[model samples]
Target: MQFTTRPTLSGTFGMVSSTHWLASQSAMAVLEDGGNAYDAAVAGAFVLHVVEPHLNGPAGEVPILLAPADGEVRVLCGQGVAPAGATVAHYKGLGLDLVPGTGPLAAAVPGAFDAWLLLLRDHGTKSLADVLKYAIGYAEHGHAPVERVGETVETVRELFETEWTSSAEIYLPDGHPPRPGELLRNPALAATWQRLLAETAGAGDREAEIDAAREVWRSGFIAEALVRQAGRPTLDTSGERHTGTLTAADLAGWSAHYEAPATYDWNGWTLCKAGPWSQGPVLLQQLALLPPELPAQGSADYVHLLVEGCKLAMADREAWYGDADGADRVPLDDLLSPEYNAQRRRLVGDKASFELRPGAPGGRTPRLSAHALVAAVEGEGLDALG
Candidate 1:
């Protein structure tokens, strides 16, 4: 008997999918209440912050792709940029080669909160209070902590206790991380939302109110708190403490913007994704490198082709992808050209190739360090597993 891992899911009505059930349910509830996709997404996203803090939080990024019935598809860039003080010289001075995986030094200008607001303001019909209520309820009352949440708390327990005392106050209540499936509450998070709402009390209409809230977040109390914390040195994965480079000026300077999605047409289907700034373009690049006809689903040949294609695409992503600003802008137009992919597709041979090969689009040289090449090979291997 063959048992498939992925079951066929069919639904008569609309469906909302997320990592957590509470988030999916919250989005569904919004839709049931006559809200649009944008409104439902905002509601669900906020719920995720409360229920799955281990996976996502207010400080994270969420690049949203909107396909409106009446309008063309657009990409909302929610990913935050590196702080102004994050420079090669600064890191070199810190005796660090790579960005620390954990700590204030690793922090970016938080984009999630503002991105959600931007979506709400431009596309959604719901008010800030309407979408935020569910998250507030979950945070103030309680939500069942997923197993990974407890495990994450355990992983960072020592750090929280020793340096990040504020985190310990919430994740380690009474000197212990919450057990899995135990009801956990974060009243402080709820209070913060409440305060944000309070600040927008007198703002005129819906759009005006959302704008006011954005101001409060970017230039007001939220910005102040973030800067204060970032200024303090915190323990990191480097076995040392380091202060963040983020500033209120950086927060104030940044805002979420909408851009046309990078797209690829394959086998009568067009796939749109975020631009070169993100890894989204890698999928399109991979498809361009693959054959017109794919092997049977779940087959070894199909998996092999896909994995090989991903390696080539990811290498290019590491080599060519960068911020579309100044001298570092990626030559996306040249990379996505059919001529380029045709040349790259030849790299896929009969056997597995462990070499990390990045194509030279527009005759531009790929400047990857020896260490980075090794890391890319290892990273792509892990990505192939799941």
Candidate 2:
């Protein structure tokens, strides 16, 4: 018998799981209302944007993996690409070595909007109105704010008040963060979605309506708002106000597409993950380096080995993995090969290793990013000063 802390759940019909109860309930409601898994996922994701605003939002990216009952498992590449103007030269000219962690400069094309619609267009069996109703209701009407939402608001309260007044208007009600369980609403976000739905009117069928909504998001009012904001100067983590280089063309140029998932067979199971552009491939590489027979879960030996395997894989991720569009990209085929992993696995030893060791895949030398090299040089300088 397998022992576990949580009760083993079993079900036959359908199930939905999410970080927030509201999101799960919204998905389950869709499932109960005869929507398929894809429909339920889209509904759930939108609710997460509303309820877990501290964590996820419409501007964020999504990498989706789905297996249709009649089809093979595939990955939907929802991760947005950087704007054309977001070049190394642009940032270098701006006197910045790294992109600010906050502000419009850090944003990619808002892929979550089109990606969710794309999934619904291709795989889902519901109308756009049907999927968005739950999120719209939550955003327009008040919903109890999560504890973390309040905490996140408090953390950024000073910044909101001083730098981002638009955010302050939405998050800070009555000039303060809402206490836990207090009802919070975002009428602006609700209006955005409502306008999207309104724009889809007169589109032929459900598929056409979804496509129309996609266009509205990319080139219509949504794009207008984003480009307007991008052109404005905003305070960032760099402690300087910088206007974004992203344009309306940048938002219009990008769209989410599907691609084959990278897979690794372990024991009797095949695991699928998004490709090199994401941190997902690191998980596959870690599995390849780890022993086939792992020690029991939660054991000290298991933890040690897992940590050791991860260090080697993470180092390679820092050095090799990047956007697949360019000529220079991840050597994924060679990295995942049995021969390559066998050679790399030998480096994981009993002791914890602090050195960053990126592997030479296909005998090609690994090149660390300029940012990584700079960080290393800075660390050495600090050490010398100490």
Residue lDDT tens for model 1, 17-119: 9889999999999999988889999999999999999889888998889999999999998988989999989998999988899888899889899999999
Cα error of candidate 1 at position 190, Å: 0.3
Best candidate (score: lDDT)? 1
**Model 1 regions more than 4 Å off:** 1-13, 324-328, 369-386
Instruction: Look at candidate 1 and tell me the lDDT of residue 260.
Output: 90
Q: TM-scores, in order shown?
A: 0.93, 0.94
Model 1 residue 57 CA deviation in Å? 1.0
C-alpha local distance difference test of each model: 0.87, 0.86
Q: What is the total number of backbone clashes in candidate 1?
A: 0
lDDT per residue (tens digit) for residues 309-329 in model 2: 897788788778887474146
